[model samples]
Target: MLPPDLPPLPALTRAEAELIDCYLEVVDLLGRINPARTEHTYGGLRAAQALVGRAAALRDALAVMHRRGESEVHAPTLARALRVLDGERRAGRLALPPSPGG
Candidate 1:
């Protein structure tokens, strides 16, 4: 059985770690946005659009890392990013948003 608190094994390469950091920053930035403000302010909307775009690029980067046989330590991070992008029309690929009351 896996350790409940353990992260994925086999550590990240320098490049992979950089990508994860970028992904995390964008995710954190989006979390700071207020949905009501985004609907009204130009800057807020643009930030949301940029956040959505970066999430897609991160997905592609994760795919490349997978092809190169890196450890799956970033999987959970990617999943969180996807959920943030979910229901965002600008985000490419199929994304299912979190269910209500979930």
Candidate 2:
């Protein structure tokens, strides 16, 4: 049985899938590190934690943007892609290129 007032589910894009994968990886890492109780000792762990938080926030933001029915297709798509890439970068799965000035 379905709720009559509920809207249909939106189709997730490939970018969204990648974002989800990155998120899952971060979650797994967090789980592994949590028991060690060594987050304070390692800079990478703390950074990873921050990345998790940021990724979560980005996910929430994407959902809200999706629900708002914004007519600008490009905005939503770009936002979606960026969020995924950001998560990947944070997770150390993707290395960011050096800045031009460097």
The estimated TM-scores of all candidates read 0.46, 0.34
- lDDT per residue, candidate 2, 1-102, as tens digits? 974554332456544544455555555455445533343547556656677776775576556547666333554654454454454344443433456799
Candidate lDDT scores, in order, read 0.57, 0.53
Q: How high a TM-score does candidate 1 get? A: 0.46
Clashes of 1: 0
lDDT of 1 by residue, 1-102 (tens): 964653343355655665655676565546445553243566666767788777777777777777888756666655554444442333321234456799
Candidate 2: minimum summed lDDT over ten consecutive residues — where?
87-96
TM-score (C-alpha) between model 2 and the true structure: 0.34
The window of 10 residues in a row where model 1 has the poorest summed lDDT is: 87-96
The runs of at least 3 residues in candidate 1 whose Cα sits more than 4 Å from the true structure, single-residue gaps closed, are: 1-11, 36-40, 74-102
Which candidate number would show the highest TM-score if scored against the true structure? 1
| Model 1 pairs in collision | none
